[model samples]
Target: MRMRKILPACVLSCCLTGLMAPAAFADGCPDQEIAVETLKMKRAEDSEKAGKLKEAFNAAKTVAWECLGNDAGKRREALIKRVGRTLGDQEEKQGRLKEAFDWYLAAGLEADADRVMLKRANAKPDDTNAVGNAIDHFKRRNNEARVREMRGIAARNVDKWLTAEDKAFAARKDSREELGKARDWVYYAEAGSGKVTERAEKRGDTLATDDARRSIENAIAYYQFADKPQKAKGVRDKARKLGDEHARKGENKLAVEFYSLAGDDAKAAALEKKSEAEKQKTESARQDKFKKDQQSLEKELGL
Candidate 1:
């Protein structure tokens, strides 16, 4: 009975040793499962760096699962780093810049993140977009030392440009105001001239009145300054009509002056011819009447 109990105890001890020896060995060194997972992860990262994306992805997946199963802390860290770098590379190649940046940052590689972000900023879609992207990247890296200075320079340039624009706008506004004042002056001057012309006409001095006539001429000049050529022409025509009427009244010198004032050279010449003919007729009539009277007197006296 004693031999039977000893034999059974020895067999049970051997079975226990068999189980505890492997556990001891595993505890003393790295676990075989973890080691295998680490090797696979390393191979995957190497392949990825060599531009073998598909192979890297497959190997990384396998290592990740194995590391999880083995509950290996160091191996898990390595796997995560490898997978993150591979994802970052793939995202960069595919033009997914933000995603690439996130993956590189997760892998604890800030330098890579910065490089990728700068690339994205450079690939901006429009003029206003690049500044926003560059700012974002610099902020992410905590690199604000020079960013503020750059921002200040940009602000200063904008302020200078805005100042110039404001000056130009003010100059344009002033010009427009001056033009408006000139137009108003022309309107009032024309109205005053019209009133003066009407008064002069009622007083029978429409053509002979120098002051009122001068006002009408000034009014036409002001209308031209106001860019109203049609209105100016109308006023000039009225002045010409009044002057022509004065010229036809047998006022020889006065008619010449009026016709000249009316700018009617042809009418003035005709009127001058008529005046000359009238003078000759008056002289001839006076001579004829004197001769007749003298002849009658001599007959009466029987001389």
Candidate 2:
């Protein structure tokens, strides 16, 4: 009876050892490691397909870690990258660009990151400072080609935006919000991108100059109406420079308006008087010419 029990126990112990041997005594990379990684990858794929992005991101990370040891012929590595890039694409579609960029960076998707960087840069198309930040980032990365391209695009965008502001300023020049936004972009362009500055100042012949005067005058009026004398005075001080520019350019009518807004009533009145005189002189010349034509006609008709 003792022999029988000992023999059966020995056989049972040997069978258990045989069953556990592959995992216990195998090399660092056991055959089952590949199988385990594949199963994890499958879970990641399922999570992604189900739109469980957070879960998918976590699951894919596990698979990526597994790939470090068991990826054969780099197949698992390729799968990890593919899954990561797909997750980033999903995030991008949802307008989560920063999150998308993070995933792309993790997935080793440089091209995808580049594309998102451009879109993110232009997300606030009217905000030139926002665009400038992107340009600065690209410069740090030594992406000169992208920097040039972005500058051109940013210049055109702001130039278009300034056009809309110019039209609005003509009607709602007293709107501080509109004028402030215009100033923000104009200053950014002037500071960061000469391309934008040139387009802004040169496109409408005297677009920036004209708008500067008009904006200042409107701002002064707005502040004065709001009982903010100090603010109005400040605006008027700024208007004087614009008034001088117009006066030097022989735009007497505009100079009159700007000087008046600047609280230089004497200068404004003088310019207005000079303009009236010029208008009278022009009318006189027209009348003299008309009289000459009438006399010629009457003489020819013997009237």
Candidate 3:
């Protein structure tokens, strides 16, 4: 096109071109000939080779912040994670905890940011909200051990916050859409001490066990009414566990109830038979006592 636009590579890297670098990057990427994302990766990689870690981080972060979508999500995600994490280390080394936390989030590496959340959690054992917040990142990462650890902290506190969360689901329990929310609350609450099925079976505390039973029952009702068979089936699996445990513990009625709810007709039928036999034996004993009492009354009255 223009003569000035036709410069050789050496002429482009002169002081004039070097001074133009920032403006050129600002106006558009350095190379319009290459694909934008590829050019961006090259810029960051070049900065890294030159030991300009911040520049490299900024280049990759620009893509993450501005260019993210199907392409970046598929292709450039690892590069974004790398540069962001590398810069986060630098920031943390400089004692910029908040900055490091921000960088970790930008990298989509919430597990790294969890290190900062853990600090706040340790600082405030009684702060259930803090523990709850700390658990969320690990939950996203599917780190069950860390989530349980955070929930354990929340369990010890047992403040109004947890009660509010527990009651929130109860408040909206009747709506079909809200049942999943109820299950979520139950998951968080019972996951702390034990799962709802486990708690129901333990029978260690009357209030806790009753609450678990009611929650599971309500969940079953909601699932049936909502036609959510898959979710219902999952809860039924929980019911099976409770049924076996109750049977082992000699709670025949509860065992039969749970087994029926679990759709285990054979187990339910067996338990029901045992329960019926026990009922008949108790009735026979009652009749024998009644006859003995009648005879005593007649003898005492000289009838």
Highest lDDT among the candidates is held by which one?
2
The runs of at least 3 residues in candidate 1 whose Cα sits more than 4 Å from the true structure, single-residue gaps closed, are: 1-51, 54-107, 115-128, 146-150, 153-303
Across residues 170-286, which tens digit of lDDT does each residue of candidate 2 receive?
675433454345445544444333433333333322222344665565555545434556766766766777778888998998888878878899999988898899999999999
Model 3: per-residue Cα lDDT at residue 104: 87
Sorted by lDDT, highest first, which candidate order results? Answer: 2, 3, 1
TM-score between model 3 and native: 0.33
* Per-residue lDDT of 195 in model 3: 31
The models' CA-based lDDT, in order, is 0.58, 0.66, 0.65
Tell me how far the alpha carbon of residue 260 in candidate 3 is from the true structure, in angstroms, after superposition.
54
What is residue 6's positional error in candidate 3, in angstroms? 42
TM-score of each: 0.30, 0.41, 0.33
Candidate 2 structure, TM-score to reference: 0.41
lDDT of 1 by residue, 141-239 (tens): 578853453344334433343344345435532122323332333232222333323322322222223334654564454455445566556665666
Q: How far is 280's C-alpha from truth in model 3 (Å)?
A: 84
Encode model 3's per-residue lDDT on 27-116: one tens digit a residue: 343434235766776787788789787787778766542333455445456666787888888887887766787788888888788886
After best superposition, candidate 2 residue 279: deviation in angstroms? Answer: 51
